[model samples]
Target: MMSNSTGLLLHNAKDDDDEQSPFEEVAANISNKDDPTILCLTFRSVFIGILLTCFDSVVFQFFAYRTSPLDINIGLIILLAYMMGEFMSKVLPEKIFNITINPGAFSIKEHALITIMATSGTTTTFAIKAITVQRIYYNYPVTHVNGILFILVMHLLAFSIAGILKRYLVWPASMIWPKTLMSCCLMRILNIENQTETTETRWTMSRSKFFWLVVLFQFLWYWFPGYIFPLLSMFSFICMIAPHNIVFSQITGANGLGLGVLQFD
Candidate 1:
């Protein structure tokens, strides 16, 4: 009985040790995958900043000429700023900004500055394109000076309104910018992967086929209208006659902005 009891005790101790070993390994693996917190905050700030810029572009769409200032947009400029901020922060001397300032890192203020600069470039481009479109396409009679004034005023308006409102709209506690949050998470994962030895192989289909398919559809839509539609219209006209049909007149007048003809004849 004593020998059996000793054997059972040894077997239970071995199982306990085996169980504890895996938990420790998992904990270490998690620690290895840790990402810098700054990555999340920076990414979110940039994303929201761009979102505001895009909103400005959208507002321009409702105005004459479908113009944005500088032909610059939120998507392109904000992305450029984020990339440049990261690069510049890495390249500039650590003490350039301040004696205590660190290289390759920034406070919220610095990040906002980068975002604003990038947005300025985008807005400027939008304004230029808008003015060109108005001059060339819409035949806007406004002189060069007035156009410049309009562009400047519109830009200032958008920037001031967006800047003032961004804080209240973007940074509420428990508020979720879902797209921005996803972006933040993706950036964090990417950063963590940078420290790992593992290489991830991505699987994707060639987009050429999809691109061609879309091209083919668009070609058909336009081609059918340009060629077949005119032919069909010609055939309909050939089969038609001007009988002064009351029903036809009624239908035609129904499509117009006034009531159908009322005749006592």
Candidate 2:
């Protein structure tokens, strides 16, 4: 009787495993588990989300006209939000004026919510492009009020469309967004306790330390190609060999066909 029960339990476990999604990364990183008691829409999450959104929108819009534009990707935002969330959890008082402020440790759900909000805000709206084109190319004056209304309407339409499609696109288990999966994995990693000790790697460096190290290296290295020597941005040997040759320039120049351009930036 004992042997039969054990065999039946193993069979059920195998069936459960087979029913899981085929994507190994998704299965490994994402948990099917949920805790309904956990707080998601806390003060920290809202404040951090709005702050990062405004920051990202302003920075990207300001740098859009530059020869090399800069973008703060969701991965960086996840890291920043994680750091800020942790900081707030530790610094903020538990309760003030009969209200709860710090709600225990930073949770993965709160981090994911903040990340989604921040990511949504970073996207450039189509209305901005339309307004710019009308004013610049068509010479059509777009008043401030009209421009604001246009943007608001466009956003509303986009949200409405997304809501209509949510059932087919978002609810399905097969709908695995690779970019969002990456953010999910990052959130899981950040929320894990004693990650530095639990993780075994040859690098021997913590994730935060490694992140800062890479940022520092990129910052110092970009100067060479970005400003110090712009030519280094696109080093075409063929163009150098035949500077006066229009055919060679067209085939290999950075601004042209770029057939054999070697760029570091």
Candidate 3:
């Protein structure tokens, strides 16, 4: 029942579309693949990475318990980091007393590394429940020293195990780090340094405009689920039928072992 001519035409169009896979972007940007400058493991990178990680961790921890959990987007982080790095590069003296301390330029490599460090710390602290259970439920003795040590040990143990196995499953260059790749693309699109061209009106949306548009949309839309009509997030015909059936609703309700069948109403 298929037409061979149409299929052949589609195949030919695909071949002519400049078949460049986005995942291979990390490999494509190298003029000399052996050059190590792209790694961006400088002193400035470490300093910025640490600062951003602290900020990112705070943002994530603050939102962890909110009814409408909000994630600080990586693109936003990259934008902020770029602005801060640029400000320092331009305003800060590159050398003090003829001793060079600052690079005076923020490389894409440095930006990427900073983003990666921040991301690692932003994940939800899974060991929080253990501390809570010990303190609140069991009424066991809990001190700041042991609590901090317990968290560090748990976090480091997972890191150590994964790191040891990373050479096999994670450290390979062939593995496309999806999150890193996305961050890279965002950086490339938002690169604002060393520009000399005048702005032009475009048919397609620019990244800056698109970013603000998304922010505006999400800000306006979330109110419906968070306040105005909270039931939009989780609704079921079963709930409407038997409003008083506590047992049935418990099993098929939002945040209550339900399948999470969402409905508009």
Assess each prediction's global lDDT (C-alpha) against the native: 0.48, 0.84, 0.70
Candidate 3, superposed: residue stretches over 4 Å from native = 1-34, 97-99, 191-265
Write the candidate numbers in order of decreasing TM-score: 2, 3, 1
Against the true structure, whose TM-score is highest?
A: 2
Prediction 3 TM-score vs. true: 0.59
Q: Please, what are the lDDT tens digits per residue for candidate 3 over residues 126-238?
A: 77767877878899867889888988999899999998988776544555666766676677655532232345543456565676688799889888988898888777666
Model 1 lDDT, full chain set:
0.48
TM per candidate = 0.33, 0.72, 0.59
Summarize candidate 2's per-residue lDDT along 1-265 as a digit string, tens digits: 5698899999976664455556888877777656878899998999999999899888887887689888788888998999999999999999999888888988888898899888886768889989999999999989999999999999999999999998788655566889888888777767863245445655566565565678799999999999999988899988899899998899989989999899888
Residue pairs in candidate 2 whose N, alpha carbon or C atoms collide under 3 angstroms: none
List the candidates ranked by lDDT, beginning with the highest. 2, 3, 1
Best by lDDT: 2
160, model 1: CA deviation in Å?
3.4
**Greater-TM-score candidate between 2 and 3:** 2
